[model samples]
Target: MTAPLSEQQLAEIAAREAAASKGPWLEGARRGNVPTLYRPLTSGDGVSTYPSVLFELTSVYGGPGDMAFIAAAREDVPALLAEVERLAARVTELEAEHPSRFAATPAEVDVYLRSILAEDTYLRYQQAIGSEAVREAMDDATAYRNCDDNASKKQAWRSGIDDALGYVDPDGDVGPYPSNLLCSQHNGFGPCPGYPWCTPSQDDTEPGDPS
Candidate 1:
């Protein structure tokens, strides 16, 4: 005679399948883990508090105001990813068109680097948003989602953000890196820097000009 599978065992099996189906998404969750968003961006006293890997997971899987917001993000992630990818491609194309501009100065290069990195991270995060694992994690019991567990989810979440942040923190309170780049350059806002989650500041008037 054969034995039937228990509900717990069945749930575990389903979870495993979901995670494997979306490797990149799980990776993002693992990197973005944070205990909470109140953490600062510095390291020591009087300094900014650096973002923890756990925060990323909580931000994505964790609902808005203790509610589930993953479903809506799930719907939006594809479009967001597409937008970032297109932006990144445009950056590369523009760089090719104006090689001299990108090679102008260190500050300009820094700006370009930040912009590209931000775009790249945006794409990766969107990939995570579409991941079966994240969706599974969000759809899982509200209690389970809150539990710390292995911290893998959090780490994965940050990884996506870190992909484009360079030396910056993804969920840090310093504002989006792409926006910071714009502020450094144009000194205004309204531009996207061609990436998702990156809002321009009051300084971003002209597009990035390495020259």
Candidate 2:
């Protein structure tokens, strides 16, 4: 029986999980772990605050905001793990009471885990949308949508920050937006260069570049 986690513990677990794994989504939540994302990209060089990982746990905090948002959005990890352990414990108790006919295999557990993971993902996404930065950006773009008949306007609010940041896609009018950081070609150490986050000004666009 694991006791409840303190706030610092929660934050630490969240940081460790975000840097490493998909948190409770992939891991059973019963296991708190680290950067599986770093493996394929490095010689076990360990996880830095890579570009992709920032967007994984939550898309809420970006652009000038620090890594704190990742910690806030990590609620899903513990929440998912609690649900998993509670369900598994119940299943075990039931099987114990009726061993002759009752059983819970790992695959069966996985089926339930998948459903729960989906639900948690959705819940976290909604929370990300409601986050302060995202909500504010959406509000900033709301007028554009209100004035235009374009369907893309409806989505403008979410991606409005890209416009504000002057990071328009190649098609400025309609965008999949552009990344804040580009993979630097001049990385000195020769490895992936940490995919370190950069500013709009630091982007690699040249005059001939489509973007």
Candidate 3:
């Protein structure tokens, strides 16, 4: 039997099909057409000769060609939506067997970071950061949304790494670069190229984790 579709395949197919349904509508809507509905009034009351309210209205409530395309789209959109829904359900089902999308709590991030810091090589650190959970902690702008200020953003990410190592390891040895350094205080510099301010604890062995 043919293999069941992968979650990746299902996600790609669902996205493409959904976009296809919108493509024709966008094409028809963007087609250049400026009829009397959009032109300067030759002679009329204020409503006709005034600002772009009429133009905006006509754009939304499109004229003849738009109505025809929309009528056809109305027929196809429901089926397209239904197919998209079905594919979404299938993707959901298949995805259930995969790893849960990781969202790292502070404690979990700490655990992951500390565990790796104890190791001579940060293999675990690199691997874990690539995980959706740690990525959210370290680098995801959407995940760390309040990081509007540059310093806070830098602190947010740097502190995660530091906190992980700052905690004493199982052997009671603090990580090579513990959080006691207050690396955040070192904000104004050419580059933080030393131990506390900048230390390459985690090195990526493969092509997945961010540099």
Candidate 4:
């Protein structure tokens, strides 16, 4: 497959489009079976005429499809370019807000997985507590949901849940623990509380250790 167009290539295309004559251009009266492009002109009296020829298909190889596309591109290119730029900007904004969504590398994937686990754990804790104060605090802390600091707030919330649930940090790090250990520690029981699939037999490893 061909590589995607870069911002520079897009900008170059935009520049060419801008430099081209303004459109609402049309295929003018054919000259000896050859197609010609004409910019519709409006006189001071408001009469429209196709006297101004913008381009002509002089080559014998050109067809009606080529003429049609070239005529339409005067306006279509700019509109398509605009949509491309808007989508690119939105993707950039999303990447900035939640970079893990676009993670590619193994380490990045691990971080993304950890973040998902942390968020799930944090949400479960909040739901179990069912306290208005805690909910309000979470909302306040993450009010600027698109901001970079929101990530830190999420980490803080996860840490708080870890402390409240008495999670043992086997790795000596304040990040995601193994799912089996998390489930076991969550309810002070061997079986996972919310997750029906997780059982002691399925994960034979001890609470603080992961195989």
RMSD of each: 31.0, 31.2, 18.0, 14.7
Off by over 4 Å in 3: 1-68, 104-211
- Cα misplacement distance, residue 136 of candidate 2 (Å): 78
Tens-digit lDDT track for model 3 on 21-103?
22212222344543222333323554554454323323544555544444556544665566677778878888776635375
Q: What does candidate 4 score on TM?
A: 0.29
For candidate 4, give the lDDT of residue 103: 51
Candidate 1 wrongly placed segments (more than 4 Å): 1-68, 101-211
Off by over 4 Å in 2: 1-69, 101-211
Instruction: List runs of model 4 lying over 4 Å from the truth.
Output: 6-12, 43-124, 127-129, 133-211
Clashes of 1: 44
Give lDDT for model 3. Answer: 0.43
- Give every collision pair in model 2: 20-34, 20-35
**Candidate 1 lDDT tens digits, 1-211:** 1234456755644454443322123233232453222222344465544545322333433334322223334533554466567767778899888787635653455455556666445434434433534444344434444768667866664554454343332344444333232332323422345333333332343443322
Error of 3 at 70 (Å): 3.5
What range of 10 consecutive residues in model 3 has the weakest lDDT sum? 176-185
- Using lDDT, give the best candidate's number: 4
Q: Which candidate gets the maximum TM-score versus the true structure? A: 4
Candidate lDDT (C-alpha), each: 0.43, 0.43, 0.43, 0.51
